[model samples]
Target chain A: MTTTSARAAAADVVIRTAGLIKDYRSARRGRTTGHVRALDGLDLEVRRGEVFGFLGPNGAGKSTTIRILLDQLRPTAGYAEVLGATPAAGGPAVRARIGYLPGELAMQGRETAGDLLEHLVRLRGGRGSGRIGPLAERFGLDLTKPIRSLSKGNKQKVGVIQAFLHAPELLILDEPTSGLDPLLQQEFLAMVREATADGATVFMSSHVLSEVEIIAERVAIVREGRIVDLDDVATLRHHAGQQVALRFADPIRADEFAEIPGVEDVEVTDHTVRCLLRGEPDALLKAAAAHHVVRWVAEDRELEDLFLDFYRVPAGELHAEAEEVVVHGR
Target chain B: MAVDTAARTPTPAPADRNGARADGTRLPVARWVLREQRRSLTLWAISLAAITAMYLAFYPSMATDEMEAVMAGLPEALMSGMGWDRIATGSGYLESTIYGLLAPALLLVFGIAAGARLLAGHEEDGSLELEGTAPVSRRQLLLERFAALTFGLFVLCAALGVATLVLAPALGMEVTSGNILAATLGLWLFVLAMATVSFAVGAATGRRALALGVGAGLAVFAYMADTIGEMMAGGDWLSTISPFGWYLGGDPLTQGVDGAGYALLAGLVVVALLAGLLRFERRDLGV
Candidate 1:
């Protein structure tokens, strides 16, 4: 069920789905059974120009949602709208204005990257040939090789180029950074940001929390075909704190370390120790100074912690415990 | 990193409609089908050319004196295997030879090509998934593919027709332009029927080897059944079920043109085509 509040009304949304569901009937057993409920009453809305990160673990509805938006898969029930028109009615024009990188991109083996790009461009009603070179150059892709000869990562690069070649208004990428190295990942995020700046909206799905945390303006985390959390990353991070590590020059006894206010749990191995701390780090640092402060590292809990938290894995069961610490702002 | 200082840039060129025809001219589904078949098309064309040449090379002796030997002395086992015994010499020896050999070869090639296109080729390369996402509907995809298969059969038939026209004079065989054309068309219909069967098999199994194997097996079975039924029953009634039976009954060598038989073959082709299309449309891709 979708709750249309005042903020959603003001955003001029480009894509929205209400109570979306998809069921797959298995063919093998001759008996009509084992329906995979890939998507279940998913309620999602993406506003214009915002880079919405759709995060979920494997078997969640991330790819399913993107497929529904592209009109590749029919929903068992519920309604989906893209750019103000129903996905069913959107047809080629809707496809023309949207760039999509499918979760699995296995292209025809015989065609060269240039030929494939040319064909896709023509399908999008563009001057297909010349754009292939420019797109390949921008993505650092080689267009001369046959599709079969290229590795999976290179093939993904070709898919990326073809998707971006048409310069569609909305880019829906599923696990876009999987094949990219760290440098390329940064470049790709830059490209996405540039596209967003030009009024194009990017709705990306990924399981990588760190990558999502880097550029996502708002994120929706899906678990078991349901949206578990949807909010700004900074806000989620503030509520979920950072992970901290500290090392003392002298060996600190376990009982002595446990007595500190903010140090929730402490593990001592010989002269080194690790602690999970909540709130500010100044108080913990002061406590550690009584022994000998050799090296100190204090950082907030990562997005993974917040993601795991939403799964209802109790705080006691979590390996790390949270503690409150007092820090004075200089 | 700071936001792009360029503030705003003009919307990138409005999405290109790549290469889909403008104003929706809708090229006959044949073009798209051929586009998918691009890899193996040249090799298929070359093989068809070679088969036509071979058929032409042996037409002389096979049509005349040797024809009498084939009728009187050929082993029953070989005769049954080749579907040769059922063709009466009264229908003319040349028709018997052409009907016995060329018809089966055409049907086999058609089935093989259909199997490759519908099953192994698409599944192996993953274009099957890509096609599932394309704007083209499932029925449209099948129709276009069938159209290409029909066109390929036409080219093969034309090659055989040209070969027959050239071989008739050297062999002193009676071969009218009308008879050769009618027989070629009849042969094409037989191949089309087989292709349609393969199309259905491919859709049902979604496996290349299974579709090709089952289609070829079905054609051979239909031929053998018709031939055996004819030898024992001594009537054309039972042969009506087999495409091979229809083509032979058309008598491309002697009758010049069996319009009624050819018409029946065309009817069967249409029926098979409709059945295949319906099955394909209903079945899911990438299954």
Candidate 2:
């Protein structure tokens, strides 16, 4: 199964991992050492020219995966390749073509944003300053202010600008919109779209479901260091469906709505009925219309709730849902 | 967006865009590291120069025969341990008082602090993640940071040497330019060896406390061994293994340069630096 998907995405596989595993050990005096498995047989693939979202909660090894891709950390077992080259073999050459923003952005020294950016450009072998002016303007960042003096949002802007200033072939951003205002977050999303439009690939990791839904075409949901669900945004939205709640003028029988298609977890209490509605809602709507409707409310199920559901269900059950989507979408 | 406009602008060719060179060499990471340490380097140089100037200025008043007689009456063991046995001669006084004990001690503090900041401090603050993600390899980053440390130490020693040279004539001291240069060179090498040890340990462990503890503990032990070893029976050989002994063992000021001692110091530096680079390359960063 892995080989089949690998062949399908062979032409444009920007990032690939095979049975990747990372383990951390802690040793204390007079006690046996303890070990934690950060990543366990994780296999993932990211394609070029696409904005791929890596979604996971804290301690899900999201940062560990990013560090491995950048060659900052070596995996305990298995392999990872970026841009068709293993990170260890082609380390500097591969990193040169990629821009990365860490989950927590911290700048050292007393250098101003301009000084640090210029220095980073030189480290990449670019002459003078490479296109920082326009980026700073877009992010509304002041170039002359010292990085330590900048607020969290402004520091994030510096991180974002540095990653984009070099115009590399790929951008790997971890929690890119963190510490930014709502308006700035929107601007950041626009910048990501602009980068993708210019034929660059973006691999972003975040726990924010709405942000990923806004920008990513596809997402890989990781749990306990392994990717459990990989699907298109539209398909996940279709499977998640909408939550429907209705209060009728007359008391309705609980079995009256039992025959409605695409409804689950139905609960009928006195004059109120609440349930999850998937697929077409026409049948549920028609059932609700049989009696005079005093108040009707149907809200789209949040992607965050769907993500929690993915976490609650067993991997085999989620795989079954994904398989159904793949069969139907094909 | 501005990115669109900048993209549309006629930029250089793809080769230039990637910032690769025909010689396959990119920009040196050392330059960036050096730039970051500029302010601290200046402060260290100035502080070292001030200390040297103060000692040189008081040489004239302390060069009297009465002072020499008083120093001579002191206990032989105590004077030898303090390195004040030769407190009358110009070169001997400078070597025993400053270069032998005080200068290296102060410079070790400087070196250890700088080394800790280079690796462990950055790691603690989470800035290493951003720096490590660049085009530079781990070996390149470690080497460049070590280069910055070496450069800063050189500047501090150079400042001290020039200040001593300028003050010698005014204070009626008969110190040769060669002696001053030799002493400064020995002090620089000693401090550099200590700093390299700190850097290597820090890079390997990625913890500031361990680096400071190990580096400082070694320095303190070496100093104690050199000072108190002379009084202990059969402890004369203790100084042989100490870095302080390797540095001041040759009496660099009066005897000119100790080629073999300098060679040993350089060798220690290389071995430690290689160990650091290897450990850094193999381990995880910002852990």
Candidate whose lDDT is highest = 2
Worst lDDT run of 10 residues, candidate 2 chain A, spans A121-130
Q: Estimate every model's Cα lDDT from 0 to 1.
A: 0.67, 0.82
lDDT by residue for model 1 over B208-270, one digit each (tens)? Answer: 776687678768876776676666546456676666777765556657666766777688667
In CAPRI terms, model 1 is classed as: acceptable
- Candidate 1: lDDT of B215? 72
Q: How do the residues B112-166 of candidate 2 rate in per-residue lDDT, one tens digit apiece?
A: 8888778987888898877789888888888878888898889988998888888
C-alpha displacement of A127 in model 1, angstroms? 5.1
Give one clash count per candidate, in the order shown.
Answer: 22, 0
Off by over 4 Å in 2: A1-8, A29-32, A247-249, A253-262, A280-297, A313-330, B1-10, B13-28
Global CA lDDT of candidate 1, please?
A: 0.67
lDDT of 2 at A8: 74
The worst-scoring run of ten residues by lDDT in candidate 1 chain A lies at A321-330
Please give me the DockQ of candidate 2 compared with the native complex: 0.52
Best by DockQ: 2
